[model samples]
Target: MSPASSHTHRPPALAGLELLASAVVLVDADGTISYANAAAENLLESSLKALSRQKLAAQFLNPEELDNICAQARLHKFSDLRQDLTLERAGRDPLHVHSIVSVLDEPAGHVLIELREHLQHIKLDREERILDQSQVNKELIRNLAHEIKNPLGGIRGAAQLLEMELPPLHLGQLREYTQVIIKEADRLQTLVDRLLAPHRRPHIVGDVNIHEVCERVRSLILAEFPAGLTILRDYDASIPEFRGDKEQLIQTVLNIAHNAAQALSARIEAGEAQLTFKTRVARQVTLAKVRYGLALDLHIIDNGPGISPQIRDRIFYPLVSGREGGSGLGLTLAQTFVQQHMGVIECESRPGYTDFRILLPLP
Candidate 1:
């Protein structure tokens, strides 16, 4: 049957299923698909016309389990059931998905099936944790900075007074100690200021062209690694300009690109380092628990020894770094800037490739 014919038979109340991020389908007691939403088509890697009237169990390696479940639902044995299933696709590896089957009263003899990728569920949970951690980090940093700032000034002042009160002969010998105290106090003060910088600065919103931001970061990285690294752009020109802080966006991209370049130091020296800036439009994206109709999908990819597994989860936390002498504020600040724009940043890394993705809502 044609896609239009199949869609016409779908109940009007089921139309909203198309807006969901999870794959959803309606099937009869015989396990034949009656309707598949857009997400379902994408998940199954098939079109509505192709999926219509097809057995849902046929798409999986363990077909009997799904068939049994559908039969039980049809017999009114259970109102809903959730199970983990493996879907086998031709020419692709098997996918692990969580399936929820709920009996439909309106559509008698039919059940609604929702499919969610296991990895996607993990990603969503991680994103939620990051958002919660970010809020806590903000509060902790603010209070810590305030606590340190007050004593920092007093320490510097006391060091100056101690230096002035020294005897003429002792002044020369003791001057170095006072200067050390004063200099160390100043350094600590600077550190405190940086900790609070993101909260202090205004957002400075304006029309932001994501491609322009990517180009700026690309140039900066190239300038720093002029000899070996190659920066590539795979941008979607159709992306519309949105309102945001241009400088903050630039810094966010730059911080992530710069970190990638730093990680690629060995590859750069070998004249094989390659970093790519990719941008596209993503629909039905959820950021910080709020769903957006459309969002910017930006990726900074590098061919380098990927992030260390030990610190991978804590890379966004303040004062955490994989590199020696690294302050670890780069990614923390990058995440902060992205969060300011109602977006989220995520990283996936392996032995040879690391990808940092930033998703921001579109106007």
Candidate 2:
């Protein structure tokens, strides 16, 4: 049957299944898919129209398991049934899922399957662990910054005094050495201040329009790299204003954009660099141990050489940088600001593409 006719014949109750965050698929006793919802399409990484034309057993890594589940559901009748299964997709790695099987009573021989990827649980666990680590990092940074800050002022003062005491005639080169010490101290002081800035600043809360923030950052970036870079925006106008510190949000996005531009230096020189800011609404997202019904998904994607694998895992840590002469605090600050707003930031990178995804809870 054609996809249109196939969809029209699907049980009316299955319409509500599309609203669920978990992947839901309906199949006949013969293993042919009768219906697949949006979430199922996303998990399977294929359109419902395409998936409907295939068999459930063909899409699973262990086809026997799926066959048995369907057979058992049809024979003994089932509801709220649970199973662990693996899914197979073309050109992609197999995915482990927590599957729940049930018999749709209206469709006599139809079986309903709900699939939730184990990867989502892993990501949630990882995010929680990172949030815990961030707290520890902040504490350590505060203590270390204070310790270093105290000595830096004393060292700079001593260098200035020493320079003054040296004779102008014979010890001029010695004064230059003292000058170096003072200059180095100042640089260290600046670093210490930045390390403590997040803690020192007050979070000024207000309704923030995300698009305005993106526009501000885009204008600044274009002004800085007018010739070689293109800043593209794909925004969802339906996203509503949320409570946040607007300035902090702007800084957070700007920092990430600046780093992307810097990473695109080679592409920039060749005049092929592209940076895209895409915004969408994400539903049923968990951030920092709390589940949000709705959240803003802001993506900063760049087409450039990706992050170095050596430092990719540590990129969010303060003072960790993949590039030479980098202070390595931009991403750290971005993460800090996001966490302050009860949001999460994640990244995925390959050789030719890098995406920084920020999720902020919406009221």
- The per-model lDDT (C-alpha) reads 0.89, 0.88
Per-residue lDDT of model 1, residues 1-363, tens digit only: 865586437677878987999999988767789898767876886767788758899999888988888888888899899988999975346899999988888668888899999999788898999999999998998999999999999999999999989999888889999999999999888888888999999989999999999988888888899988999889889999999999999999998999899999999999999999989877677888998877898989899999999999999999899989888889999999999999999888888888899999998
lDDT of 2: 0.88
Per-model TM-score on C-alpha atoms = 0.76, 0.82
lDDT of 1 at 28: 70
After superposition, candidate 2 runs with Cα above 4 Å error: 1-21, 25-98, 107-110
**Local error of candidate 1 at 1, Å?**
15
